[model samples]
Target: MLAVIRYSVPESQSQDFIKQAHVILDTLAGEPGFQRGRLARSVDEPNLWALVSEWEGAGFYRRALSAARMAMYPLMILMVNEPSAFEDVYVSGQEE
Candidate 1:
């Protein structure tokens, strides 16, 4: 499973955004079934950012996100209103 949260942040608050993103990722990392996470800024759009995390399954993703929602309520509000969870049906590196 994957959780991809996107944000539209002012460039003036870039540093602050990164710091907050780290806190979010760190918290998610401690949860069971967490695989990896990354914070990325769009090359085409300077104010666009994404917080991507991989999990073992949808259940894991939901639990971790719920935990994050409770713990980081302030930062969680910054996530753009959109669907964030996705099932990983395919991965390029894996053999068919």
Candidate 2:
């Protein structure tokens, strides 16, 4: 499963946003079922950022959020309000 949270940040606030994002990523890393996570910005639109994470499953991801909610809340508040969770239906490089 994947969890992708998008954010619209002004260039002036990009540094601070990146810092807080790193903190949240670090906090979530300690939780169970966290495969890996990445913070990315859209190429054409730098203000458009995404916090992407892969998990063992939706349950694991939810549990991670539940466990780290407090620590991540501050940064999470900056995320765009929308559906962020996704199931892995296909992957190009991996064998089925």
Candidate 3:
């Protein structure tokens, strides 16, 4: 499962947001079933950021979200849109 969270941060707060995002990623890394995660920023629109995470399954992702430590991050309040989750269907050059 994949989780994609998009954010629109003001220029003044971009640095602070990045710092907090790293903290969230670090926290998730210690959780069970967390495959990997990364943070990306749009080249065309610097204030636009995305937090992408891959989990072993939907249940693992849900557990991570419900973790008590996750509740402390202010990043959730700054999201520009609702976070999205997707199940992988296919990958190019990969066999089933």
Best by TM-score: 2
> Between which residue pairs do clashes occur in model 3?
none
In candidate 3, stretches whose alpha carbon ends up further than 4 angstroms from where it belongs are: 68-72
Q: What is candidate 2's lDDT per residue for 1-96, written digit by digit as tens?
A: 999999988899999999988988998898899999999999999989999999999999999888878766776657799998999999999999
> For model 2, what is the C-alpha lDDT against the true structure?
0.89
lDDT of 3 by residue, 1-55 (tens): 8988888889999999889888888877778999999999999999899988899
Instruction: Give the TM-score (vs. native) of candidate 3.
Output: 0.88
**lDDT (10s digit) by residue, model 1, range 5-95:** 8988888888988988888899999999999999999999988899999999989988888888755576665678999899877899899
Which of the two, 1 or 3, has more TM-score?
1
TM-score of 1: 0.90
Please give the lDDT score at residue 38 for candidate 3: 97
- The best-first sequence of candidates by lDDT reads 2, 1, 3
**Each prediction's TM-score versus the true structure:** 0.90, 0.91, 0.88
Which numbered prediction scores highest in lDDT against the true structure? 2
Clashing pairs in 1: none
